[model samples]
Target: MDLVIGRSRSAAARRRREVAERRTRAIAAAAGVTTGAVLVAEVLRVWRRGDAPLPGETEDVVLAAEQAIGQTVEVAVAGYKGGSTRENALLNLHLSFLATFVLTRVSTRLLRERGRWGPLRNVVVGDHHIHHFVPGIAMAFLAGGVSIVSRDEDLDPYLAVPFGAGVALTLDESALLLKLDDVYWSEEGIVSVQITLATLAMLSALALALRVLRRGEAEVLEHDHEIGHGMPGMVVPVPSFP
Candidate 1:
């Protein structure tokens, strides 16, 4: 009798897993199709707009988006004193990581609450549940590897986006890793939030410090240059012999 009950339980568990896997596959397929469609649409739009100004009401929307993005870039560059490709890349990475983390947290919360995100939930395979960190690790490694091998400085910022996103994903589950089990949605998961906040604070402080240092250096250099060139209205000090 006990054997039969055990078998029944196993069968029910298998069925539930199968249903979850099916839902996961459906969600993945839909996402892929949507992403492909958007990419194709963007490509066609850009191709059609080549060397020509956008006309009509669409122009307003496009210009608005472009302006917003441009302003964001300008702000980041100014804040980080991003005068070089590497500095710009780091700034982009920092912004991307923070944005990804915020989005991830919101998505997870929605899923937990069974909100409007239909058919998208935890990924389960057989008896084990796959976490976001798995893909996060893979993405981080891939981005890091590409950045290491690529010689183009222009590509660094692009790579940094994905690398930052991956790191954010991984760090979002830091508490799970620390506990060696899923503590997400539990009180213990608060630790992950704390860690993420701490990291952001540290990075922000470091960037501010670096910017201050660079600005001071530039000012000193400029002052010295003016003194060396003997610019008008500039005073120079000379040593007096005793």
Candidate 2:
């Protein structure tokens, strides 16, 4: 009887530990997927859309997509024709997205190089508090920094809404240590809320990429000799994003 009881207790403890691990993994996995997808999306958005107005590019996304991604089921959603100047606003949205990607990339680098200057993690940055508060917050600021440009892209900020919200929520959730996720571990889990948020974040990041490329092009045009290698449009300046 004593042997059986001890084994049972041990099994329960093991099960508890497994449960905690799954939650952690769920959050981290969500962040990773979000980040990667954002990167890809930003790359494409910038490639196609080009630059936006500075100092307010981000606002366009918020005005358009704020808290909206979760609300939309049909991929067609809104956000296509953002404002009175819908075309311009869309361009700015793309610009803000490009800048966001640059910032996210910067945060990733900090995780690697500035980990000591910031927080400590168990092989994963998102698992750490500093990752949430410091790097995550910085990225959030980039996301929140919007303008008429962003506002102009007023139709929908689908990617920005959920992506920003998810990062903020996940960071908070980690801090609170919510033991809500127990089933999404080491398996092909369902397309959860976290998953959707991550997708939105990825698309936003992709938009940022396009903005940066467009900005780089403008710079190259001003000083053509400085940049030795780039395509023709690579150096052409895009009008201030809508």
lDDT of 2 by residue, 77-98 (tens): 2232222343433444444444
Q: Backbone clashes in each candidate structure, one number apiece?
A: 0, 30
Predictions in order: lDDT? 0.65, 0.44
Q: Over the stretch 1-242, how does candidate 1's per-residue lDDT look in tens digits?
A: 99999999899866765665565456446644754664455334432433223444465757645644443333334445535678768766776787787678778879778844666688889998788899889888999899889878888978988998899889888889988988775545643354445356345635643563345434443444566688768677998999
| Global fold similarity of model 1 (TM-score) | 0.51
lDDT (Cα, 0-100) at 172 in candidate 2: 35
State the displacement of the C-alpha of residue 81, model 1, in Å, after optimal TM-score superposition: 10
Off by over 4 Å in 2: 1-16, 19-171, 174-203, 218-242
The local lDDT score (0 to 100) that residue 205 gets in candidate 2 is: 46
Give the TM-score (vs. native) of candidate 2. Answer: 0.26
- For model 1, the run of ten residues with the poorest summed lDDT: 45-54
